[model samples]
Target: MSVSNTTDFTNPSTFILLGIPGLETAHVWLSIPFCTMYIIAILGNITILFIVKRERSLHEPMYYFLCMLAITDVVLSTSTLPKTLSIFWFNSRGINFNACLTQMFFIHCFLAVESGIFVAMAFDRYVAICNPLRHSTILTSHVVASIGLAVLLRGCILLLPHPFLARQLPYCRTNVIPLLYCEFIAVVKLSCGDIRISSYYGLFVSLLKNCLDLFFITMSYTQILRAIFRLPTKDARLKTFGTCTSHLCVILVFYIPALFSALAQRFGQNIPFHFHILFANMCLLVPPTLNPIIYGVKTKPIRDRMLWLFTHKRT
Candidate 1:
């Protein structure tokens, strides 16, 4: 933890990223699982995109949002994992300041966008289940496109200030980020300037985005559930609810680890550093890796398409 006197105080050119604070000795071993997850995430998401695109029957609002989620997952995972593996494997930890900010922006921006996509997917389910007669008309192609645009813009606009704010802060302290990637809070904490504004702003934005999205998702699912129970036949209820199972699983996969990681990073001061970092890495990796698998297994259309593709390739 020795601070170098020669380090630039005002504006360092680069910052050193310690992949995981206390797990330095095990970085090589850690890279194995991380690399595997990265490969799976990329291939799975790509397969999802391919299946949805090639299968004309799957061109509905629900799958469109799934495509958006897949794309976001790819970007989100790509923004950090390569750099993380580099840090772990080669000990290549020096990240240029601007590159760090870029990484931070992509990571946070797509994370928020992913949350918004979940809200959109939930709304899609609500319409399909609760208002079956008008589902297609309600979520038309134009409307779906607009929803995707709005979600992307909202994420970009909300997170655009993060890099600027961090840049404005004078880094009179050590230019060392003690995390896997350039996390917003970790980078900002390096500034010697008063960081209350940045900290509060980050907190406010995080809570605002997650809470609003969660509220909308919950409301949509509530209506969906009520609609499901109102169906007279048990078979009808089961069949209808089954359509939502995949989406619900994807939502849980994305949110549970995300929320837990955020809470641990912000509040769990007593949590072990390595544990927190590992959990946070999983929070990012698990969703992308599992999302395609979840949908492929639970959604019959996707499952069938994937099987056909694989079997056809063999033939």
Candidate 2:
């Protein structure tokens, strides 16, 4: 939405987003499919959250982290999807500068929380396999709660200062963000003046959060593999692999595109914006919608319960 008398320092009144070049005409129609996908994704994540909340059998540390993953996915998807959908459905890309900053803040916060949750889940997996005897005590409910709180606090701390950086820049250029929603890099690039320091800070935060998170997750998985190999029984090995399969898949789908987009932004290697925007968006939408189904619908216990809930069939 447009703010009151807030003018771009260069253009004073108008801000054009150089949007997906020529697709503005078709965006209104495209939103139909976008909305459909979003509804399904949002509902699926919510279902996962509800299942974890209701099923006492699913109260292990893995599931606890899974529940928080669902929460972060919901927030992350909601942060951008609705706004992007609105622009397409209504052709109303009237986001003000401050409002754009708000969106960026939430997007970064949710992304950070999701990354932290992934890292914590990896740690849980490591403990479950490499240190089975201590898993129960090491990952008690209180410990899980504490981890969630730490993630929340860390997300807020990481993103809160980012908006202030935007506030420092005088928007002396065209206001059009080139993307549908207010993407941080795209928005920051719109500044007419130098933003070397801003870009440096952004790079620092991105690296500190994403690379470090991926590093720890990888470390955990490496240990898990060693422990799985150490198991004497084939059944034990299969069980360990089975439990980690869902999370491993999630990590792949969530990380690859995100890391690619981060690289594209940092390097500016002349990658097409459309490609960047498309994959970048998929990073947000695809995971949240698919995770619940991949994790829950495919699991024997969850599938049976879900089938019973829907069909009223008794085993």
Taking the tens digit of each residue's C-alpha lDDT, what string does model 2 give over 184-260?
66767777778787889888888999989999999999989998998899998998788888888888878887877
Per-residue error for 193 in candidate 2, Å, reads: 2.9
lDDT of 1 by residue, 197-225 (tens): 99999999989999999999999999999
* TM-score of every model versus the real structure: 0.97, 0.90
Per-candidate RMSD, Å: 1.6, 3.2
For model 2 the local lDDT of residue 184 reads: 66
Q: What is residue 65's positional error in candidate 2, in angstroms?
A: 1.2
Give the CA lDDT, 0 to 100, for residue 257 in model 1: 90
Which run of 10 residues does model 2 get worst, by summed lDDT? 3-12
